[model samples]
Every structure is written in structure tokens, then in C-alpha cells.
Target: MDRSRTALIWRYAGRGLLLTPLLFLLVFFFYPLGSILQFSLAPDGKLDFAAFQQIFSRPYYRETLWFTTWQAALSTLLTLGLAFPAAHVFAKYQFPGKSLLLALATIPFVLPTVVVATAFIALLGEDSALNGLLMKVFKLEEPPLHLERSLKIILLAHIFYNYAVALRIISSFWSNQSQRIQEAAQMLGASRWMVFYRITLPLLLPAVTAAAALVFMFCFTSFGVVRILGGLKYATLEVEIHYQSLSLFDLPTAGALSVIQLMTTLVMMIVYTNLQRQMTQPLNLQSSRQVARKPRRWAEKGWLALNLIVMSLLIFAPILALIERSFTLGDGGFTTRYYEQLQENPHRSIRAVAPVAAIQNSLEYAFFVTIFSVLLGTLAAYLLSQKTRFSRWLDPVFMLPLAASAVTLGFGFIITLDEPPLNLRSSYWIVPIAHTLVAMPLVVRSVLPSLRAIKPSIGEAAAVLGASRWQRWRRIELPLITRSIAVGATFAFTVSMGEFGASSFVARPNQPTIPIVIFRFLGQPGLANYGQALAMSVILMAVCAAGFVLIERLNRAVIGEF
Candidate 1:
């Protein structure tokens, strides 16, 4: 009777704990989303569809939407074309420095979009070192590369940012795929290309399609890259939303665009999720050790070396260029003047924060964002791990933030939280709150699998032995999932450190984050300003790199999920 009563109590307690994440979603996610809809559909408290009508009727908005679609499609195709062969190499071979190469490939995916854009500009901008070298060598008066602020640059940046998503997904999936079928086909005298086409291609379609969908979603909503590299010519929905809401103060139109983007991404997420579920279904899986081998033939060695060189150039060249350019001057001398300028505030501009101060502010914000995200996201994971009806449907609801654009979330925060009880427009906590919202989805995704993998029998046995619920959780469940929690926390910290789109809206001018500082420096003219921007970007990149390294050390097996 006592055990039964205890079980009942624990069950109720678990249900109550589930409410925490729901309340968080209500106040932060759903409330803000509702406010956006309300503002757009019924500004001045009267029903109106003019915003929607304008978006549909206007050629500019139509062209923006069309451009957004085609660019995303092109990026998806280009990334797949480049990453597919690389994925094959990573999956089917054992090479020296393989682990390090894979890790380096993934770093770009985690970097801030602003940093990615900055890296490209440092490498290919008219005043860049590459251009300068070419001009000097060829005796040309003008820079040969005109890729800056062009569609080509935007597409290139997207490829750089998203290459890892396809590579990791496909490689990880392919590594486990059984070789028996292919081997059997080869025994029957099929050519290598024929085997790949007839057997391997069909099997890999799900992973490739899923990767394509996710890459499309990211490029479709791209803001920082388009805004920085595409200049005034290109505008994705995310950029248009930012322009309308913040620049023009057209809250209604921005909200409409947000709704359109939100619906589109939600559909893409659904497709991706379904495909991922297909990937997780039972299969005749094989270990990488059984499938992968070192190159034995000269031809194989040459192909491997060629792929490695291409991957290295694609992933590392821009970063190296950015680092070198940060320390280089027009006079062909290297100096630390740019780094030194980070500490001084010569202009004393109210809108500008010192780079040193910005760094400090980012660390503090990241700390709190990590705490909030871990607590809330862990709770959400716990809730979703249960077998109850409530948990089943709630799983996708928790993932809604992943589908929602960060820019839209920021705009929603601006309009929704202006009242007395929830007023946080100018509060210090606002930035952290917004960041927490963005980071929590990642935390939930990282921790959920670990929680669900825990056998219920162990917890039942502990309860049967008179172990209290809290004691069982603290002693057994906590230790078992600590690594997963750490992974989530690290991701949250990294994400908070580099977040730009949402930060642009919520971060105060006087207390800007590192990305904001970099953006400001980039917007200003002169070589000194450009150099400072590069310096700040390098600092942010280093922080993100360190965080990723910690995560890599924590669990290499789980990094693929990221």
C-alpha cells in the first residue's frame, strides 16, 4: 500500500514538473507568436488583411519570396554536390588526421553567420589580400574578384555554413549501412558505378533528402549572410521581416512575413522529421570498423588526397584568410594594432560598446542562457520521454522553436512583452531571455535521446527498494545522463555566444554582444574599422571553436546529431 501510494505521488510529481516547460513555452514562444498574429491581423484592435494582401499583391514581396526559394534550392543542390563525395570519403576510408578533419569541417556549421560572412569578405573582398596579391602580380589597376555583395558570394557562404549538415548526416548513416548487398552485387560482375547507382544511391536517398530539406530551411531563412554579403539586392524572408519591423516600423507587414516563413519552415521540419524517423528504423547495420579501410591502391590514394585537399580549401581557407587579414596592413606589415584597439573607446559613442566590454557581456549572457536552457530543456525532455498521451503530442510542440525564425522570435518579443507584468523591452534580462529561447531547442534535442534510452526497469527497481523518486533520479538517472546534459549546455553556451539575428533586436546599444560589435565595425568605413571587425570575429570564432572542442571531447558519437 505504501509503495502504491508512493508511485501515485511520484507520477503526480512528474506531471507537475512537465508544466514548467509548457509555461515557459506559453509565456515566451506561444505568447509572442500570438502577439505577432494579433498585431498583423488586427492592428488598432480591428480585423484587417491589408498586410497579407500587400505581401501577395506587391511585386517586390513576390520577387523576394521567389528569390528566397530559388536561392535555397540552388544552395541545397550545390551543397549536396560538394558534400556527397566528401561524405563517401569520410565513411568508407580510414586516413590519418581523419578525426581532426571531420571536426574542422563541422566548425563552420556552429559558427555565427556574421563570422562566416566576415571570413568570406576577408578572403574575397576587393581590398582583401587575395585581390591585392592578384592585382600586384598581374599589374591590374582594379581588383579582379567582384564577388563581394553578389549572389555568388551569398551562395558560397551558404555552402560553407551548411556543408557539414549534409556531410555528417550522410556519412554517419552510410557508415552503418551494411556492405553485404553491395558485395553480393559486385560478385555478380557489376561495375563500381553500377553498384553505387543501383544499390547505394537508393539506400542513401532518405538521408540525402533529409539533409537537403534542412539545408533548404536554413538558407531560406538566412539573414546575416544575405544582409552582409548580398547587400541591398537580396532579401530573404528573414531579412525582409527585419527590415519591415525594425527599419520601417511596419509591424503588420513584418508579422505577415513571419507568419509565412513560420508556416513554410514548419512544413519543412515535418518533412525532415519524417525522413529522420525513416533513418532510425531498424536496418541491417554494420560497424564502421567492418566497412572502412585504408586506401590500398595508388589510384585510391590519389583520389583520397584530392578530396582531402578540396575539403581543406573549402573549410579552412576563409578562416585562415580572415585571421591573416586581421593582422595585416595595407603597407604589407603585420601588427597587433587592431587587437589593441578592441580595448579603447576613443569616440565615446553612446551606441558603441567597447569590444572588451562586449566580450564580457557575451560571457555573462551565455552563462545565464546556459542555465535557463538546460533547466527548461531538460524538463521538456523528461516530459517527452514518458509514454503518456500528453507527452506524445507535446513532443513536436516543444520543437516548434526550431522551426521559428530567430528574427521572428525577436520581433515577437518586441511587440508582446511591452506590458507591465511582462515588460522587458529595455531590461537586462531580455537578451538572455531571448537567447535562452533560441538555445533551449538545441538543449532539448541533445538531451531527449539519452533520457528516453534509460530503461524504466531500473527506476522501478529503485522504487521497489524504497528509493524515493528524487533519490533515484539524483543517484541513477543524473549520473547516467550527465554527458548528454553537458553536451546540451555546451551547445547552449556556444549558441548564445555567437547569436546575431535575435541579438540585433534585443541587445542594447550600450551593452552590445560580440556579434553586434562586429556588425557595427563592419558597417563603418576605413581599413581600421574593417580590421577591428575581423579581430572581433576571430575572437568570437575562437570561443565557438573552444566550445565545440569541449563538446567533441565529451562525446564524439553524439556530435553527428548537432
Candidate 2:
């Protein structure tokens, strides 16, 4: 009778714990989205489709939509093409510093888009060192490089941002898959090309498609790159939303664009999730050491070296340029003026604070966000990992937060959470809440694999030995997945540290984050402002890179789905 009562209590407790994540989403995610819909479709309690009509009827919005789509498609193709060969090399070749290379490749994916823009500016802008050197060398009066504020730079930045995402996903999947099928086909009188086309291509298709969809999703909703690199001429839907809402104060148009962006990203995410599910199909797997080999021939070695050089140039060159430019003025002597100027409010601006304060504000928000995301994400992970009917449908719903753009989510928060009980527009807590919505999905992704890997029989055995549900989780699961939790926590912290889009809308004027400060510095006139922006970006980059390295270390012991 006691055992039966205890079982009933534990079951109810489990169900209650599951409801926490659902409640969180309902209050935060769905409520904000609903507020945007309500505000856009029916202002003053009347139905209207004027915003939607304007988006379709106007040439400007129409062109923006087309540009957004085509650019994303182009970026997707270019990223996949660039990363595929690298993925193949990483998967099949056991090279020195392979793990370090993989970790370095992934750092860009975590970096703020603002930092990426600054990196490119340092490398290719008209007044950049490269163009300056070229002008001096040829005794020319004008700078040479014209890539900045062009379509070419936009594409290049997109590829740089997403290369690691594609490489990691495809290579990780490729490494685990068995190569025996291709070997068998080759031994049965088929040529290498024939075997690759018939057997290898089909096996890799799902992972490739999955990577493409995710890359397209990112490029489609790109904000910082377009806003910074493309300048005033090019505008994606995300940038348009920001313009309409903040610059123009046109909420209807902004809300309409938000809905469109949300719906489009939803489709892409759904496709990605489905493909990812297909990618997990059981296969004849092989260990990486068993399949990977050292490059023995000169041709193979040359190809490997060539790919490595390209990867290094593409990923590391701009960053190195940014760091060098930060310390040196256009006149060529190294100086610490920029770093020193970070503490000065030269203009004594009323609306903005010093860059040093922004750093402190960012660290505080990151601390709170790490706690919120780990708690909420762990609950969501446990709920979704359970082998229950609810888990299947809820899985996609939880990912909806990830699909929604940060700008849209911030806009939603402004409109929805302005009431008496939930008023947060002026509160500092609101920033962390907005950041948590973005970071939680990552935490969930990082922690879910650890939970799913646990066998049910082990839990059953624990229960049979008179262990309560809480006791079993605390004693067995907690210790087992500690490293994964740490990895998730690190991701949440880093993501909050560099978040820009949502912070732009939600952060208080005097309490800015690091990215917000960088944006402010860039907007101001003078070389000092630009130098300060670069200095702050380098600082933020170092923090995020350090976090990424820690995550890699933690994740090595327990690999996560991320």
C-alpha cells in the first residue's frame, strides 16, 4: 500500500515538472507572438489586412522579400560547397591538430554578427590596411578595395558565419557512417566515381540537406551582417522590421514582417528537424579511427594542405586583421589609445553609458541568463526525452523559440509585457528574460542527448531498490550528465554575452550590453569611435571564444547534439 502511494505521488510530481516548460513557453513565447499578431491584424479591436497588403503591393517590400530569399539560397549553396570538401577531409583524414581545427572552425558560428562585420571592415574597408597598403604601393590617390557595402561582402560574411555549422554537422554525421558499402561496390567491379555516386551520395544526402536548411534559415533571418555590411542599399526582412519599428515607428509594418519572417523560418526549421530525424536512422557505424587515415600520397597531401590554407584564410584572416587594426592607427604606429578611450564618455552623452559599464551589464545579464536557461532547458530536455506521446509533438513546439528571430521576440515582449502585473519594459530583469528565450533552445539541444542516452532499465533497477524518482534523478542522472549541463550553461552564458538584435530593442538606454556598445561606437563619427568599436568587439570575441573552448572541453567527455 505504501509503495502504491509513493508511485502515485512520483507520477504526479513528474507530470507537474513537465508542465513547467509548457507554462514557460505559454507565458513567454506564445504570449509575445500572440501579442504581435493581435497588434498587427487588429488594432483598436478591428480586423485589418492592410499591413499584409502593403507588404505584397509595394515594390520596395516585394523587392526586399525577393532579395532576402535569393541571397539566402545563394548563401546556402556557397556555404555547403565550401564546407563539403572540408567535411570530407576532416572525416576521412587523420591529420595533426584535427580536433583543434574543428574547434576553431566552430568559433565563428558562436560569434556575434557585429564582430564579424567589424572583422571584414578591418580587412576590406576602403580605409583598411590592405587598401591603404595597395594605394601606397602603386602611388595611387584612392583606395582600391570596393567590396564593402556590396552584395559580394554580404555573401562572404554569410559564408564565414555559417561555414562551421555546415562543416560540423556534415562531418560528424559522415564520420560515424560505415564505408563498407562503398568498398563493397568498388570490389564488385564498380569504379570509384560510380561507387561514390550510387552509394556514398545517397547516404550523405540527408545530412547535406539538413545542413542546407539550417544555413538557409540563418542567412534568411540575418540582421547584423545586412544592417552593417550591406549599408542602406540592401535590406533583408529582418533589417526592414528593425527599420520600421525603431526608425520609422511603424508597428504594423514591423509586425507584419515579423509574422512573415516567423512563418518562413518555421517551415525551414520543420524541414531541418525532419531531415535530422532521418539522419539518425540506425546505420552500420564505424569509429573515427577505424575509417580515418593519414594522407599517404603527394596528391592527397597537397589537396589537404590547400583546403587547410583556404579554411584558415577564410576564418582567421579577418579576425587577425581586426585585432591588428584595433591596436594600430592608419598612420601605422601601434597605440593603446582605443583601449584607454573605452572608459571615457567623451561627449558626456545623456542617453549612452561608457563601454566599461556595458561590459559589466553584459556579464550580469549573462549570469542570470545562464541560470534561467539551464533550469528551463533541463526541464524541457527531460520532458522531450521521455518516451511518451506528448514528447513527440512538444519537441517541435519547443524549437519554435529558436525559429523566431530575436528582433521579433523583442518586439513581442515590448508590446505584450507592458501591463501592471507583468510590466518589464523598464526593468533590468527583462533583458535576461529576453536573452533566455534565445539561449534556452541551445541549452535544451546540448542537454537532450545526455538524457536520451540513459537506459530505462537502469532507472527501473533504481526504483526497484526503493529509490524514489527524485532520489534516482539526483543520485544517478545528475552526476552522469554534469558535464553536459556545464556545456549548456557555457553556451547560455556566451550567447547572452554577445546577443545584439534583441538587446537593441529591449536594453535600457544607460545599461547596454557589449554588442550594443559596439553598435553605438560604430554609429558615431570619428576614427576614435571606430577604433573603440573594434576594441570592444575584440574583448567580446575573446570572452565568447574562451566560452567556446570550455564548451568543447566539457563536450569532449559527453558529446551533445549541438
| Candidate 2 stretches greater than 4 Å from native | 1-14, 348-350, 460-469
Clashes of each: 0, 0
Worst 10 residues of 2 by lDDT: 344-353
Q: Which residue pairs show collisions in model 1?
A: none
lDDT of 2 by residue, 1-562 (tens): 9989988987999789877978988998899899899877986679999999999999999999999999999999999999999998999899999999999999999999999998898889876888888998999999978998899999999999999999998998898889889888888999989987888889999999999999999999999999889989999999999899889989888998999999999999989989999988898888988889999999899989999999999999888988999998646899988889888776643255788888899999999999999999999999999888989889878878899999999888888888978898889999999999999988888889999998889999999998977899899999988999999999999999999989998999989998888877777777888988899999999999999999988988995887
lDDT of 1 at 469: 80
Residue 425, candidate 1: alpha-carbon lDDT? 91
Local distance difference test scores for all models: 0.91, 0.90
lDDT of 1 by residue, 5-107 (tens): 9889889988888789889999999999999998888987999999999999999999999999999999999999999999999999999899899998999
Each model's TM-score, in the order given? 0.95, 0.95
